[model samples]
Target: MFWQWLTAPWQYEFMVRAILLSVVVGLVCGALSCYMVLRGWALMGDAISHAVLPGVILAHVLNLPLALGAFVFGVGSVLTIGFVESQTRIKEDTVIGIVFTGFFALGLVLLSKVKSTIDLTHILFGNVLGISNTDIYQTVISSVVTLTILFLRQRDFLLFCFDPTHARSIGINTNLFHYLLLSLLSLTAVAGLQAVGIILVVAMLITPGATAYLLTDRFDRMLGLAMGLGAAAAIVGNYVSFYLDVATGGCIVLVQTLLFGLAVFFAPKHGILARKFWAKIDL
Candidate 1:
């Protein structure tokens, strides 16, 4: 039975597409997340993921490509957050709260308007059971763009993340780089949203990076570790989805969560377990 399905899985283009999309999104987000964690923007990633939903629905309503709408709304939301924070004397967290809630509410309203005609469930939760070749191509393109952004700005991003004061002193366009990084993050989130849904999509963006932090302190090491963990989760989640009939994206997130838990318990100096042991031995 296993052999039969394995032999025939690619006979269905949708299955192939689903697998391809999952891997591409995972890889792209994993790489981008290294910068996110160091910049203290993990929660921002979560917010950005949720922010893209309205754009997606608006596009769906207008019969446009979801990615196009997602990028527009996603970038718009990031700017709005900046505008709100600067215009009001509010804390950044408060601004983030306002932006995600307001934008997500807008998405829900838009989805409700077309809920009868469209399978809105797939929009929120994703219908990754099948995908199109177009989606596969788009995913690959997005992955490349994400990588290119990271490569072109790696030094600036790293300096901003590790020591923004020094980065600014060195004449980096710290503010421009900051906003541009957030914009890139939103773009990555939008790319993954259509494939993985918001919850898992955001979770993947944050989780692998968090896990990598637990495993390593060096920037490049963390990036490598995050990518490896993400790819591993995708493979395991795919198997779990295929054999156990679970949600693929959620299952992948679950794998990340478990890995994170383990990292917390058993990783090096920063790990809870390791820190405790060191204190006890010294005492």
Candidate 2:
């Protein structure tokens, strides 16, 4: 009975597509999450994800591909933040807050005025089960490209994230890497739209890497663990959502959060309980 219950969702075609896209989203987000965590760019992820709303709205109006608009706005937001912070005395966080909120508000206003069939709820929260074939293809393409780039440039990105000053001294173009990471982040956000939507996508990009961080000190191990955890969360969450009739995206993120919670107390070296146990042994 348990096995049948677990396998029931795969009986349908839509569920299969949703699961495949969700897994791709999870893996790409998980891989990029490591770089974001190491670089202290968590807020940047939030900003880009939110800032893409206007692009989505514009795409609907223009009858263009939503992913294209999303990528444009996502990358535009990053460039805007970088420019504003560099030119003015304002800090990056403050700039991020202002820019993302402004863009998000603009999107809401446009959404209210636009006479389109775009669902705001789906845009914000995702509708994974309703994913179409086009969305699947788009997501797969974007994920493949993003993953390929990340894999090829892993060493450079790691060095840049760990220490920009050292990377610059060693002749790596820190500027190029900075924008490259942001661009990849934008692409990931676009790919994740159908699986987790804008609001929750950042969580997907954050939680896996965070959970992995607690499990290992090595960057390579962190990447592997985060990717595994993310893919697992997506699979389990989809099954839970199917049986429980909950929001698929929310379920996925909740699963990731639950894993993070477990890691907090159970991870071998960095977990709270582990540290306390080790301390007691020393004493």
Candidate 3:
């Protein structure tokens, strides 16, 4: 009975596809999340994820690929925010809030008009189990492109994220890297849409990286650990969801959140209780 329960979810093709897609999305989001964490761009991820909604709707209505529409709007949102921040005294976060909310609201209006063809629930919350072959292929492509860029540009991007002035002094084009990272962010969010939807994508993009940051100081190790945590969460979350009949994306995010909570109290150097314990020992 134990063995059967463990192997049960793989008996169907849908489960296999769902699990594969989830793993890919988890890995890609986790890797990029390290940079997002370091750069204080958590809100940016949320902004892009929500801002893609209208693009997805527009794509469906125009019979274009969903990813294409999502990518366009995601980039558009970033550009708009940048333009706003550059032209005024407003803060980046404030600009992001205003822009994303407007795009998401527009998406909602577009969604209402096309309710018959598009499912708002699925777009907002995702349907991993209902993933199609086309989605799998697109996810695979997105993962490849995202991972490749991250690997090749890791050092340069890290410099930019940590200290943009230093990166500029070192002859790196801060503007170029900034936009490049945003492009990757947009792609990853679009890819993640199939597994976790817009709402949970922010969690996926932030939680794993935050958890890994608490546990490690080394950036490479942080990336590896975050990816592992995310992939494990997705797999376990899917299995638990299958048995309990709950929402897959929510379950996955729940597991990531739990892991983060654990890190908060137990991580060696950064955790709250760990610091207290170390101080006591020092005394």
lDDT of 3 by residue, 1-283 (tens): 9999999999988888888889999999999989999999999999999999999899889987777898899999999998999999999889999999999999999999999988888888988999777778877898899999999999999999988999999788999999989989988898888788888999999999999999999999999999998899999899989999999999999999999999999998999999999999999
Clashing residue pairs found in predicted model 3: none
lDDT, candidate 1, at 102: 88
> Which candidate has the highest lDDT of all?
3
**Relative to the unseen true structure, what is the C-alpha lDDT of residue 123 in candidate 1, on a scale of 0 to 100?**
63
Ranking by TM-score: 3, 2, 1
**Clash count, candidate 2:** 0
Stretches > 4 Å off in candidate 3: none
What is the lDDT of every predicted structure here? 0.79, 0.90, 0.92
Give a tens-digit lDDT track for model 2, residues 21-47: 899999999999999888888999999
RMSD of each: 2.4, 1.2, 1.1
Q: What lDDT score goes with residue 200 in model 1?
A: 65
Cα error, residue 195 of model 3, in Å, equals 0.9
**Taking the tens digit of each residue's C-alpha lDDT, what string does model 1 give over 1-283?**
8788665555666666676677777787888878777778877888888888888778767877667777787778888998989998999998988898788899888888878866766766666776556656666776788788888888888888888899878777788888778767777886667566776678778888988988986888888888888778876677677768888767777888899999999998888989999999999
